[model samples]
Target chain A: GAGVSQTPSNKVTEKGKYVELRCDPISGHTALYWYRQSLGQGPEFLIYFQGTGAADDSGLPNDRFFAVRPEGSVSTLKIQRTERGDSAVYLCASSASGTGGMSGGYTFGSGTRLTVV
Target chain B: DQQVKQNSPSLSVQEGRISILNCDYTNSMFDYFLWYKKYPAEGPTFLISISSIKDKNEDGRFTVFLNKSAKHLSLHIVPSQPGDSAVYFCAASALRGGSNYKLTFGKGTLLTVNP
Candidate 1:
């Protein structure tokens, strides 16, 4: 792909339902990251993957949120028993390398706006 | 605790004027800083970045100034245009696992360039 891609630009789900968001990063990008942005707030880190393995998951809000990058090229974010507070724009970014100095920083997707009512 | 802070929630500037957005960080270990601009229905795009080693970095009409002593960084847009109106976010990063990848972002400052 020419750039990072995220599916389901907008999602409206019932509270307590399960939802999944997918991200497809740029070709050959070795580093993938997930972020969540609430109203009036900047994007907050959720998780980062160096390759197929998650290098950092400290930013995940709680056990209800989980992400996996099985092949290192594509990733999925899974939410269980979603709450109304879970509504937000989920962003995905990818870099050629894990270092910003080398990859010139991340290229982000348009993001998936999740709404739980 | 907020590691990065953008005190101003909004800024208004006239076209052809200069627009300055400020940001402050509490983390002293942050060695890299970046600025991103986002429009409605779109994701943030990298605007400019400055390494701690350098006090300033510029690209086109965008210039970023960093004050390591104060843990502050600012983005300046010269001859501001209506198209430049967007939300600007400041991000900082420190080396982790031999890489500077994780970014801490500020709440963001909305810049309105009135034509």
Candidate 2:
């Protein structure tokens, strides 16, 4: 793919409903990330994946949010018992990065706007 | 414990003038910084970035300055245009497990260019 792609551009779910958001990063990108952006704020880090294992999950808001990148190419973000406060845009980004220095940039997806009512 | 902070929620600038958006971070351990521009209904696009070793980096109309000592970085857009009217976010990343891939972003600053 030319860029990152996120499924279900918009998701409207009721409180307590479980929803899954998917992200397809660049074909060969090994580093994938998930972020949540609330209104009037920047994208907040949620989780990052290096290959099949999650490198950092510290950013996940709580036990309700979980993400996985099975093959290191595509990822999914799952929300359990969605809350009204969970209404926000979920973003995905990938880069050809392995370490620090003048490296490549991250390409972000259009983002999935998840609205919990 | 917000690692990055963009104090201004919004900024209005006249077209053809310079627009400077500032950001400050609390972590001295962060080794890299980046700036991204985002429009409504679209994801943020990578604009410019600066390494902790460098004080400044520029690309066309976009210039990013990093002051490691102050834990501050700024993005300067020359001759601001309506096309540049979007929310800008500052992000930082640290090395972990032989890679620095995760990024912590600030609460963006919306830049509106008035003609």
Candidate 3:
């Protein structure tokens, strides 16, 4: 792909429901990241993957949130018992390498707007 | 703790004038700084970036200035245009051992270029 792609551009889910958001990173990109942005706030890091393994998951809010990149390309973010506080834009970004300097910068997707009501 | 801070929530600038957005960071380890512009309902787009080794970097009408002593960085847009009106975010990244390099972003400052 020419750029990073996210699925379900917009999602409206009821509170307590389970939802999954997907990301398809750029072709051959070795590093993938997930972030969440609230209104009036900048994007917050959620998790980062170096190849097929998650290099950093410290940013994940809680155990309710989990992400997986099984093949080192497409990734999925799963939320169990979504709450209203979870309503926000979920962004996915990819870089050619794990080192930010080597990749110039990460290419971001349009993001999935998740609305929990 | 907010490692990166953008004190101004909003800024209004006249078209064709200069627009300056400021950012401050608390971490001295941050070696790279980047600026991103975002519109409503869209993800942020990379604007410009500056490495700590350099004091300044310019691209077209945009220039980024960094002061390592104060851990401060600013983005200046010359001849601001209406299309430049958007939320701008300041991001910092540091190599924290191994290959872990995550970006820390500020709250963001909204710039409105009024025509």
Per DockQ, the best of the predicted structures is 1
**Candidate maximizing TM-score:** 1
- Residue-by-residue lDDT tens digits, candidate 3, A1-117: 998899999999999999999999999999999999987788999999999999999999999999999999999999999999999999999988887532267888999999999
Instruction: Residues B14-111, candidate 1: write the lDDT tens digits.
Output: 99999999999998888888998999988888888888899999899999999999999999999899999999999988864344888889999999
Off by over 4 Å in 3: A101-103, B96-100
Where is model 3 chain A poorest over a 10-residue stretch in terms of lDDT?
A98-107
Task: Please give, for residues B9-67, the per-residue lDDT of candidate 2 as tens digits.
Answer: 99999999999999999987788888889988999988888888899999999999998
- What DockQ results for candidate 3? 0.58
Whole-model lDDT, model 1: 0.91
**Tens-digit per-residue lDDT, A13-64, candidate 1:** 9999999999999999999999999998999999989999999899899999
Model 3, B1-115: lDDT tens per residue? 9999999999999999999999999988788888989988777888888888899999999999999999999999999999999999999888543433588899999999999
The better candidate by lDDT, 1 or 2, is 1
TM-score ranking of the models: 1, 3, 2
DockQ for each numbered candidate: 0.62, 0.56, 0.58
